[model samples]
Target: MSAVAGKAAERVAQEVPAVQFRPKKIRTVAYASAALLVVVFAVVGWLLGDTPTGVIFRTSDQIAMALLGVVLAGAVLLLARPRVRADAEGVEVRNPVTSYKFAWADVLKVSFPDGAPWARLEFPEDEYVSIMAVQAVDREHAVAAVRALRELHKAATR
Candidate 1:
């Protein structure tokens, strides 16, 4: 019984799970977009005041509310909200724009380059996907994620 328990503990210690990655700070594009949203809202407020975008007597309160909706929508897009996960069987990448799950068997290559926000993967059919969710945020975390993913890929190939 003790031998079995000891083996289980060793296996548990050996297995390391993969984690998601994201940008450390807001992306440059996101900042620019946010700024643009604010500017447009400001301009609209100035030009169409107290009329609810054309009427009259809207007051500052209504104008502020109208601008708030625009800001909220902009924030949602610029954030690039997404998640990435990997396991022995496969990897799942998700975001507001796209989501995909791939078995290790389908993956052919993984690479990370300098100046890139994240890693990327190549597969059969000449298809490719960004590993941004895995490598965008930090160097240490990204490397770890890559190494872990490589292991899974190799296993799947076998």
Candidate 2:
């Protein structure tokens, strides 16, 4: 590369600011899900133990129900976690199943286009990556996040 091109790339790489976004609703949902799981397990245990024809609940069964509640709550909490972090070098997206890192130069656009379930980055090879942290349920907050990402992308490219 030419000296001018290298210096320009260096400047772009150094000047872009870092930003992170995460959904606000996830915390509320996670807590509610955990509480609901516990309640459901307790109700089921009580109902089974109380019914005349139902098999008597053993102490071990109660313990198992408690464990099941805890496991379900943990799974719900895990599913709710999503985060996005972007800096001069690249953007890192963490969703429930996997995470991805994409350099600024490779991301052509950042958008939460109409009808899209979440924010997404338009990249090379006709690829689009989801930013699950910016959810549609959050509405305006999600829009603001997408705008911020677009600005960051433009700054890094320039």
Pick by TM-score: which candidate is best? Answer: 2
Measure candidate 1: CA RMSD. Answer: 6.4
Distance from true position, residue 111, model 2, in Å?
1.8
- Give one clash count per candidate, in the order shown: 3, 0
Q: After best superposition, candidate 2 residue 152: deviation in angstroms?
A: 1.3
TM-score of structure candidate 1? 0.59
What C-alpha RMSD separates each model from the true structure?
Answer: 6.4, 2.9
lDDT of 2 at 101: 91
TM-score of 2: 0.83
How displaced is residue 63 in candidate 1, in Å? 4.7
Query: In candidate 2, which residue pairs get closer than 3 Å at backbone N, Cα or C atoms, i.e. clash?
Result: none
**lDDT agreement of model 1 with the native:** 0.66
Q: Write the per-residue lDDT of candidate 2 for residues 39-143, one digit (tens) a residue.
A: 898777656556677567787787788778878888888757889998766789999788999977889999777888788989878889888999998888888
lDDT of each: 0.66, 0.82
